[model samples]
Target chain A: MEFEMKIDYYSGDPGEFIKVIEEKCTGCGQCAKFCTRDVWEADGKIYRPINLKDCVECGACWNICTADAIIFGDPKGGTGVRFTHG
Target chain B: MTEDNFFDVIVVGAGCAGPAAAKKTAELGLKTLLIEKSPEPGTKTISGTCINLAGMHNEDLYYILKGPIEREIHSMRTYHINDARTTVFNEIPTKGVLLLSIRRDIFDAWHTEQAKLAGAEVKLSTTVTDIIEENDYVCGVITDSGEEFRCKVLIDAAGVNSIVGRNAGLIPKRSGDNMILYVTVAVELGEEVINDRFSDEQGGYCIEYYLAPGIQYKTWPWIFPKKDTVTLGTGGYMTKDLFNDKITNVNQYMQNFLNLPIVKRKLEGGKIVSWGLHLEYDEKISQKVKNGLILTGEAGGFVIPFLGEGMSPAFATGIFAAKTAAEAIQKNNFSKESMSSMYEDMIEEDLFLQGFMHVGKINKESILKKSEEEISNMMQSVVLGGGFITNAVHTKWLEGAENGDIEKVQEALDFLEFIQPYRQIGSEFEEIYRKLRAEGGS
Candidate 1:
């Protein structure tokens, strides 16, 4: 059975906030596992930030990556997810 | 810019710790700059949406922002998934502890305002790209906009990412075992629904915790009631093996948590207002300060190991860092020797020593020694008595005295006596000690 994935609840474009250095990525897939958003996807090899727009810039991917392959910064002003009731 | 762009203190990340440090440093007459990568404080930050504000009651920041506190959590309910048993721990006034459920966005915004009023220059949307070093001492930071701002002392309150501290080589990298990967969802259900469903009266909001052993190892799920929403979350150690077996993805874990009968029933019609992923490190405080740099809050590994509470520690360490930085600035000594002593002494006196008492180290061997019921009872007791160490002392002291094991009684008594002055469980411990002594068997 094929089903469509639900849209992420968070709004705004993450806009280049998370950068994955492919050379350093070991295809360990830890980033994809740690991230709640489907931002990173593993394709049998290296993990890529396939859904950067859905990224909330939580920095969990960068922190869990042992190879230091990910660089995460906050999105530009007024461009990332804004919580109304945090 | 050149050296003229320097301040006495530069605090990176305007989360819980940064603003507090900036406020204190500026109040002490030091030129201070507080920078935030987000457009506003708390916009990108993730908490369980419930903060225990017991310790911050007397602070000016808490006093100013106390209006936003949604409810005072008077009791907590724990559900043992394996046995389907529940235990409740009610708050005792004499214990001097109660959790205040708060909205972090409102709280962080209020804190930032307080810092600005105290004369700290708060720059929003300013990302610190890297630490600027001079002669092996971190003297300043370079922002993403290619602007360099030098300072006599740099404080990193940048949270679990610990960007400035990590880049400066002051904070060590943490492994997956030491990291906790968690997700939270804020479900909106209006005030009446919340009050009706959670039975919210004055000081009567309940924070429920679920221990699902079959689903995940060393993991727990929580349902915390807020003013108009309920926060559902779960956390587990970030190990590859654990991830491979159960939590292949955090979203899958969240889905599983929601599927639980209790959670589904309570949140049947509630809409998810917001969701987020946050990482917490459980490492003890180590190498937090060096020549011209200091690490505070989660960046300094201040989150409590067992319960995953960081806000209180973040606030406490932020204030301590500010005081320490002020002292160093007043003495005009940014050297490693002077600043390290000032920072270390405050941390040791206020945070580190007390933290050591409640390490809450859990292992497979310890779990194996107890029956499932015993483990459940111990978990309830630990949550009720503040932490594992206090609960252990209380249990051992009572059991040993009852069994007339002289050596065990003596050891438990001695440990209780040592930790009494520092711990808040003093009155409770004293009552037990007096009863045991009056029995006079041992």
Candidate 2:
């Protein structure tokens, strides 16, 4: 199966769980570079979590964001990506 | 906040560490609360899916072994694939199980259940959005439900990207060398198929580790077998070089790993059942405590992902944090100096956690200093001297002797001396496990 198809998420909006601190983003695109899900997208001079629903809540974009622009927070309770036991 | 919202100890994130911490605190008669974001305690988390028994030798942690488990692992198969040939080392270290294969979902849920059974109040489907601080002390937390829960001591086991740790200004922006981003995929192959492919006559299963260029960047990729699912993960330290021409992303590396002849054959009929992305913080944080708050597990930087050993440290630190919290409550002092020092002392006193961490430090340092190709060549020769630790110590001591660097030799000797007692601890733990098993355990 495709990597995308194997994942699951609760049915609901997760709110703005990930956002780019516009002023802080250097646009080096490290967040986008590091993110495997392509959740971040370039927007003029900053990056936004354009595809938040695709996020697995891994926080890679947040961790590798050199400019400290990603405010990665948990989704609403019981409403985010759900992973089966590994 | 109402009096009902107050707890003696509140543990956030019911993962590996939270449940342990809460269980310990509640067992000590402290009013405890364990909170998790997911409706199901462990359904949202992903990991390598195996626990090292050698790490859980502590008498306090023996009960953890009674949780839901999948398989007993006694053997390991390491593949060192070079341009010339592939060297396979199938090591049956002992008759006793060295590790236990687990489903993080079931295992963590079981663990949290144990905590609940031990009298810790649990709140599922709650996310701690912010913490309530009083007089520079994190004495309470605010959940997503807009309800506030206060506690004398708060335990943070919220994992690598924990907002609690970040909001406290302890978790820094970590990338590059110290951060590892690994992707894992579990394939379903029926229980019979898995048993036929991955089990042996010794009533034990094997974990396969692959090492080669393109497969992973320095770190070893692992295949761990569950009851009916086989989990395979491969990735590297989140660095500039993580992606190259050959591997554009982690999935590409996963593709290459799945393409390997041996792995491909084993996974022939298997279909990918679940996939996950995980990040591990390899380095310890500068501080895990301040005032009324304490950090445990990945939030506290207690994970050594490259070594594939974390669950034990999580349990150890969790229990230690609980003990420290209980002691602080006893003394009526939640000062950083008192609680922090006590927490550090407890962790430092645990020979198993300390020794495991020391070996990881030595091995990681050794591996990073050498290239992948060089390490593969060495493993072909090095496994005979034991594993990475032995290879590193031997090489360092010999090189020191050759270069007349007495300090270097002395350093290696000191490490060896410190690690000596830990080396023979497997049998001791195995004996303890046998006794525990006979005394009635899962």
Candidate 3:
């Protein structure tokens, strides 16, 4: 049997949320690995966001990246994971 | 920014610790400013099942959170996958000391409001980018918006990220091995379903700790019930390879935990509501206080290692840091000598240090070597002794003495014997023994 998992992802206006500096990215893939939201994907050579819309802006990718490649800021107001029962 | 931007004390990161520190500082009539990187307090906070409020008093910062206490935990059960059996430890005499369970987001937001009511100026969505130093003393901070805020003293309460502490050279960076990764999902199951499954009628909760083989970490998985939701999570020590393998793919671990028969049975119809990851410092590191600065909460590695609880320690240390900051301002002495004595010396005497010492003694390998009965006995004693000491005696200790490993039983007996004197000294240790005896143990 499979358990159903639902995640609400929020993004702000263009150029407002997470940004990966390609030059600084050394293909470490730490951002792709550490994020639980599956926001980043690895292409075997480097890492890129496959679902940037899924980013909750938790900043885990920004903090875990050693090469200082990812930039993460809070999304615009009322744009992130909304906890209904928390 | 002008000279008017200066304050008597500036606190960074308005989580559990920062707001508490700011509240205390402001209540003391200091010009205090609390800054948070998240859009609001609790926005970035993630916690496990429930917080153990053993050491907290009525005057604590936790009480200020004002979140509805979901349950008062009176018992805890540990499940061993090898035997598929459970050991139950119930507090005696109706209900003994209890723990409070509340949602982290709600609790934190309420705490931030408490800080505001205490007269601290709070700035949301403000990130402290760097620590401004002069002659090796951190006297100010530079925010992300190119604004500088100077202060006589800075409190670093930035949780496990340790942003200000690491940047200012006050604390070391946590490595993977020393960090524990927690991937949690809060599932809404409705209060009726939760009450039926846990057999809790008075809003009491149960904590189930799972120990499965092949897991590198000593403490593996846990299922905790809140008011209307259940928090399911798995935590393990982060090894370099594990970081590259399992730690990176935490959802797989969560999936495995959910697939367990014990978990699957209880959460059969729950709907996942939220998902998040939190990093905690599981090992102790030194140098939490420097000239003109103090570190509280996870930034200071204040979380207990074995249980992985940080709320009480964070709140306690927050208040302690604020008190020390107030003294430094009153005496007009921000030197490392004075600040270290005021903060570090006091923290060394706190319960977090004592708990850290106790957890450090029980090596994971040694625990893994013990028989099931021995492990159960030790865990029972741990809970009864408030997880800080191992002096409580149980009938299982006597049974193990006859049927189990002689050396292990002798070790447990030796520790109990060592504290026998304190049991008669009419102190707190005596109270613990009295409770143990009342619980039909000893």
Candidate 4:
């Protein structure tokens, strides 16, 4: 079964927006492709932050990051994907 | 004959297009029936990477999509085989135009609920087995469990595997080469780990790539960032023989991708948990409406051939079909002539279809004939020429580049014309092209 969840990037402290579990992160790099921030860079098949402070808190990297390595903070105030019309 | 339980219109398939049509039809006060073959709405749905908000109608769309969409895409990045280079852009036809990355299951369910709210009856976990016709005009439909439903209008939003269109004698069988198959792995990562990893970009958006060893069959892989999960997948063209064969072992290919310089560098510690398939269109849509029935989404072959994107078109067509069907019902007309106009209007209005039709013909030649060096040069032209559609439109100019008489400045203007409605998106195309060129050079 697929395990799906959502997180608010704009929620909580910007500094603490990212949460990494070393054991959970297998460094597969799938998250890197979805991240626009250039956060994760491979260091011998293990992904770590090049710099952690520049994140936009979009939560894309966290959602797509497998191995359950990435976690986010409290829910944000508003809803997501504000559409003009489908 | 038994008492007729007639609805103004009947929509088959509760995926993107069906729901769009249903919402509109119900809102218009047309008695509407939305049938879904899946156990729940969107249970069988699989959309491509990103959905472009190019044709959204604003008010109605906002109502339906506000809850299910995971995130909005503000920008994009494109990469080449070269590790040292990349392309990025932030321009489009409209600044306000933004696409949402959504889980198909959640989104479809939400759409079904919206249609129901508007007074459309939704039938889920049900299958439509046949279309009943008389004098070449569709009159009703039959289900596998021996139930019959009659309606004045019928819509086939059954996707690429659409049986209604084929059964109605609306379209011919498709070959394998026209098919596309995709496998996706949904992965999850920590918020802190992600923030620390990709802090350089603006919004948390998505990325795409035409990696090396690329050929006509090797389409790009996509990375879509949603609420708390990322959707990643790759697809390619196939021949009948290979298309019918079962996938050997995707794990091996995934592993190979994991070892790539870029993949290894970026996702060193990422993990994969779930996998799914996305079926590609097996034919180009030549016609979408018949005397009594109409097709939508992949069932109508609206996929973006070059990029393989279809969600936006699917959604737009959904709304368009609903309006058309509503008009037809009010006029007491369900003729093929009348419905075909709807198909034409939508295809004409869609940017994705315009761009795809204008350039889709050359995909095989461009993808299959060129070597790596030639491909790199071609991509450079796209970057320098302007935006994605502009770059693609100017491809003919590149063909003329061999003669050397074309004015360099004029090529940009000509490129703009080809993009038409998408002229504003030129810079985005240019940026991505530039990045790919830089990567190739490095």
Best by lDDT: 2
Residue B266 C-alpha lDDT in model 1? 86
Worst 10 residues of 1 chain B by lDDT: B359-368
- Give the alpha carbon lDDT tens digit for every residue of B1-442 in model 3: 7767999999988777898899999999999999887665675666734656455532454344244456556556666565555444444325443466677666677778888999999988676768999988889888767789999999999877656887876665444656666667788889889887865434456666666543324454776778888877775555445444443466666777777776788888887877766676766657788888888988887876565567778888899999999999989999888988888777766543454444444544344456545665666566666553443234325546778667667765765665454334334432453354355421
User: Per-residue lDDT of B59-144 in model 1, one digit per residue for the tens?
Assistant: 43343333356765656666666545444444434432246677777767877877899999988877777888889888998876
- After superposition, candidate 2 runs with Cα above 4 Å error: A1-5, B201-203, B426-428, B438-442
Ranking by TM-score: 2, 1, 3, 4
User: What's the C-alpha lDDT at position B139 in model 3?
Assistant: 94
- Considering DockQ, which of the candidate structures 1 and 2 is the better prediction for this target? 2
CAPRI tier of model 1: acceptable
What DockQ number belongs to candidate 2? 0.66
lDDT comparison, 1 vs 3, better candidate: 1
Candidate 4 segments exceeding 4 Å error? A1-86, B1-5, B57-65, B82-98, B196-199, B214-216, B240-252, B350-352, B359-365, B380-385, B400-418, B424-442
lDDT of 2 by residue, B160-193 (tens): 8888888988889898889888889999999999
Better of 3 and 4 by lDDT: 3
Candidate 4 residues A1-86, lDDT tens each? 22222111222323343567777889887556544446677777667756555443334445445476865431121211111111
Indicate whether candidate 2 or candidate 4 has the larger DockQ. Answer: 2
Local distance difference test, candidate 1 = 0.70
- Candidate 2, residue A52: lDDT: 90
* Worst lDDT 10-window in candidate 4 chain B: B240-249
Candidate 2 CAPRI-style tier:
medium
Q: Which residue pairs overlap in candidate 3's backbone?
A: none
